[model samples]
Target: EVTGDERYKDYWRFLHDGGMRPYIQRILDHSNATRGYRIDRLEALAADGIPAILETRTYPKIGAWEQAHEGKPWYTRSGRLEFYRDEPEFRDSGENIVVHREPIDSTFYEPNVIVADPRHPLLRPRRPEDYGADPRDVGGDARQARHVVLTVDQMLSSRHPLAEDGYRHVFHTPKYRHGAHTTAVDTDIVAIWFGPFGDIYREDPRIPFINEMYLDINPLDARELGIEDGDYVYIDADPHDRPFRGWRDNPEWYRVARLMARARYYPGTPRGITRMWHNMYGATWGSVRGSRENPTGLAKSPTTNYQSLFRTGSHQSCTRGWLKPTWMTDTLTVKGLMGQKITRGFVPDVHCPTGAPRESLVRISHAENGGFGGERLWRPARLGVRPTYESERLQKFIAGRFVRRG
Candidate 1:
């Protein structure tokens, strides 16, 4: 509403034209990589018009991006491609330069005393333990480390190891939902793309993959798990909630979030990996859950629809993920320009926090009656809150998509 409406465009225009200019200018001023560059060049190009530049018909590459500094010191903290910073922190942290740390799996085995092939003199065998530290395992902390440590030994261990050890599979979720930006999750758009196929040729926006959410598993793994194609299976994100400081007696610490979805055995899918197309469910009001008759269920928008429980299928619920706050070198500098207030301002998309759920492990199994007792099963919104489903705005969306679908 804010971006499309002209009334709302003024503020946007000011940020792009007024504020963005200075921000870019600041980067250009400080970024030595952008040495010998000026914003005026861009301004001049814009002033003369793009049509004039097009008349030349010659493509020209510009600046440090092209082969770095042709004849000058390239811009950087070191005025060169900085593999190492002169900063003491790099030296203290043992990351003085780019170095390859073996995957945690490599640490599981004793370090080979013999070098590989022995063709390269520089190559040397790795030590099981190094840097005067006892043998350690790289667990939950990809905030970084590498070693074969039982996750039970360390609270922070690698998630991949979990699937390899106890958990049966690693559930990978990618942002595949088309919201206001792509398909734009709205009634008018949904009408055009309600079902999977609009034509027999099988060429339509509503492809089978996009119409609903399903678990993509390898055919081999599917057979092993006793899951047939189109079977509604449960994906249990293990360790979804763990007790604080080893809460062995507390049952709450062992809770899991189970997401139900139809299984699709893809031939090319790796044997152990399961991918759930993310952002598809729980993004809209009536999001699909496990299947048509049984969805993951949903909670009404707490901020908007209080009484209504939306069927926004589950995804994030199945993981112990946390928002990863962006810690850029210098993201937030200035605010409050062109009537855009300061306190309410949002960090730009580039600096926005994201959920790092790679540590969330899951195992697929048959879901009887949705899911297990200790698992979080999606439930429909029960009435009790203000701004219920009776609200004029939400009712219209429901009516347009589900009610008027005759």
Candidate 2:
């Protein structure tokens, strides 16, 4: 019996390593040989070096080309003659580039996402090592790089099952929304000074991927909060004790959350942030569920239910995440429905400062709905603490800064 083979395994590796250089060179040679004068237009992008390929002017001009290809049958009104047939110029132009229906796959190899093993030549740096670098394996830093900076789009809809959620099954729409105003390379939004790519908004750098999480609150969580699109809600997270949770805590956590929560309201004019579909992010295993459809698991859809975790101090609503203070004798506890004893823990969403308290569980109060009429009217509130902005943001900025610098 014959076993199936992985046809495209080496296909990508070979193309990236060997094909890219030749392909670019060929394009350059062909463009030079076939001058704009030969084609009679100034659309050639070869005037500048390879870097020019990324310029806006070099972007392909697809305007009239589309209309011409889609132009209706070329017939004259009076004689009903076909211009395309009668005119040699028209015919030549039309026959030169035929537009045919065909399927198109836009997937292309991205250097950052492709994992590079020891054998991959591209992973190797130049010899003699620049600037006192260690003479390590050719796979240098590539071996250490594990996480990929995924855009909200690819992170949400990729065929990877981890990319989806049960909410997609129930609502037929993604439950989470990640917001990104600009590319990671040039986010002008202010960040803290924990490191280089500091937190953009406040002085704190504990917020992780603030740009990413902001989208969740502004648009996605906005709907759940009963706030209309473009509307804002204030958050009031009470500082929790340090003992029940971890001792690490940052006092600025609450204030940072407030600032970030406010910033989400205005995502700027030009770089208006786009809300990413929810359930597309977070720890791979942390928020997911289990079932036959997804035996490994399905991400717990970030929903209105999770929104409850952020409600703190009176008049405060935490749609994004939560904040907890680090100190003893300040803890709160509550029991779960099944008497499951759950302890308070810091929200893993963002970074926290040293001596900051991790968030723990808290009681939730709700009025009896009459389903089991005669029950206590207003019961104790539910409890749980999520990561505050400072803690989360600091962790992300530090992690990213270290990775880029190292």
Candidate 3:
């Protein structure tokens, strides 16, 4: 509608008619190699709509079946498995071969620190002045001189700014057992199973359990910080260039650029490491206050029924993007099925710039308003009564009333 182009409408109509299946069939018909397997009964081999190969058998196992059975070569310049890469982009970034590189943000080093292995021929050695190390004692042997290593005392005292400011815990977001990659967790049934507070009913005054975020910390770490399980705490990450610039004298300091969550003492978590379930909801306009010019609060106006679940912040408040040079290369390469086509440097779904949310650091402190037995605590409603007919069916099944005899 914005462009007013009729070609886009035509394209949409084309897609709506038969989707990508017709295009895929055309490709199979034209290709000499795949022409033999293009039979009418290909869809019958698999229950799912799309079949990987147009053969009588099920889909082949990834990385194993194609090379072993069909004598197909792997995707590479040599058309086989390769370890060493001579690509200019790979050599420039010192990632030609598999090697461990420290996270860009969550580390003892300063933010955006330049890390390089002295053994790598293309990359330069770390400067002694950059790390505040003595010039004479730095990089004597190339093999021994890898990345700059800092002692615990040095890290806490001088190296890490966050550590010096008492933000010692390394923050990471891992997958939750109840949810499948940010889906189905919003429902009350799923929310009740995880976190310290159970599901919040629709009538509850507090935020719904789906939008409530929680932090998992080691028991020892919690003890050191005088934190107890199920206590409300404010999590503050590096505020330099993150959610905001400077910390102003706002009445609700916790509501600005900081996350509030219930602290869970988990002994299973490693010391100095903290975890939160990934994909928690973010804040809305109603959750935040306006600037001084427009001081009237939207949350207080209540003209709209769109209530924000979050009090202030989000999971991405601490995260930032770190782009790798190699991923942005413009070098042309062979890609696609059977390496039949030459494409640009960027390979779809394979090579791309990605964000590192796991590389984050935070500090936790007890919230002044909320604690054990406080008003902020959520009193979860009990599960709803089961339906009569469903209950009868379950009872009958248990009693073998529906059993079949042959």
Candidate 4:
């Protein structure tokens, strides 16, 4: 959330990789300090020289040679274990240097589960039963309690077929908008951004800053068409640029794309810059052969670099819907407002009639008897409708069997 550079770099690597700018670098440094503090506290307790049940471990500086090494060890030991031997602090790491098992706590800590932060709104106790302490006894604002909660689009659903239902489908470079990389969907509920720009969510600050992939309709466009906040509209664009092949060549992708456009408006939009996210807009293709010709608007990437322009895929397709309604006027009023070209499209991620999860709408597909003909291996079914136990077993098997294989 601090700056655009860190976020984009993370996106590019398909991994969270990048250096932060000065201001953001400071925030990261603060986080490092907090981690250091925790290590220090645990070590401080252990420094008393008396052995306790609680185990404390600290990593020391590593030599240049050790830092450059990569790949898993042949013996199956993790690099973390291997790092300890050469770390500078290991010399005085005390006699008890072996790694010990972590203690199990029935109530607070649970493996494979994100423990409630007690403060995060999503995880915080809503009633007295949550904390096991009577709410009546614990007065004061409940909102102030640091509630640990998962924001709307942060967690992925176990029901999603894409998470693990590997029936085998092929993806090619040309089929994707970019070479060697395509739009990666985090089927989990996490909000997306243009690579790693920043999070836009108020509840969870971790929301990624996605680019506006669709043709954004500013307030002026909305006003001209009398479109309200949830009103539906078509995006007028040539499908030539939206090329899909191989696995993306399916009828479901087109149908899904059409349904994706009905998104809520960021109320009071500006005159110049379009504020639409990827799926926030209506159908990708619309035909208005009447006297009123739809405008041809230009979309720009955050950095003016053409390479960074909004590509076909990416979180912009799904995460765009999470942008809460904002005034259009605020964005368009920027300088060079009039000189820029403008296009309009309905926002994606609008409510699906079937009430499926929002991400389901953005999966690629085609219409019946359209350009794509046969059934594809990965057809995304609507949400809240997938199998439960079987799906879980499948996911566990896939994660266990295939994840580490590569």
Winning model by TM-score: 3
Error of 1 at 231 (Å): 1.9
RMSD of each: 15.8, 29.1, 10.7, 24.8
TM-score of each: 0.44, 0.22, 0.61, 0.20
lDDT of 3 by residue, 1-406 (tens): 7899988878667477857666666777777546755444566655557664534233442444666678777556666777776677666555566655555556554433234445555553344455565644411122122234333344344344567788788888766764676542555465455555553442332333333567888867876886656566777777664555454544355464567677766778888888887655555444554311123322221344343334456666666665665666776354653345646577765565675355577778887323323643223211111122135556677679897887
* Backbone N/Cα/C clashes per model: 10, 57, 0, 49
Error of 3 at 233 (Å): 1.6
lDDT, candidate 2, 1-406, per-residue tens: 1435556554455575755544444445455332223221223534543224322222464433423565632212332222222222212212212222110111121212222232432233222243344433212133122223234444344431211221110001123233342223133342222112223452222222332232223333333444332222332222232111221454433332331211132223222112222221232111221111233222222442111111111111112122212211112122222223433322232223233222211111121121112221101101111112134446666568545633
lDDT of model 1 at position 183: 41
Considering TM-score, which of the candidate structures 1 and 3 is the better prediction for this target?
A: 3
Model 3 residue runs over 4 Å out of place are 1-71, 108-159, 184-186, 201-211, 245-257, 287-309, 332-342, 368-406
The CA lDDT of each predicted structure is 0.41, 0.26, 0.55, 0.27
Ranking by lDDT: 3, 1, 4, 2
lDDT, model 1, position 174: 63
25-129, model 4: which lDDT tens digit per residue? 344345532323343444577799743232222333343333356542222123233423322222222101233211111111110122323243222223434
Model 2 misplaced stretches (Cα beyond 4 Å): 1-10, 13-50, 53-182, 185-206, 210-263, 267-283, 286-406
Candidate achieving the largest lDDT: 3
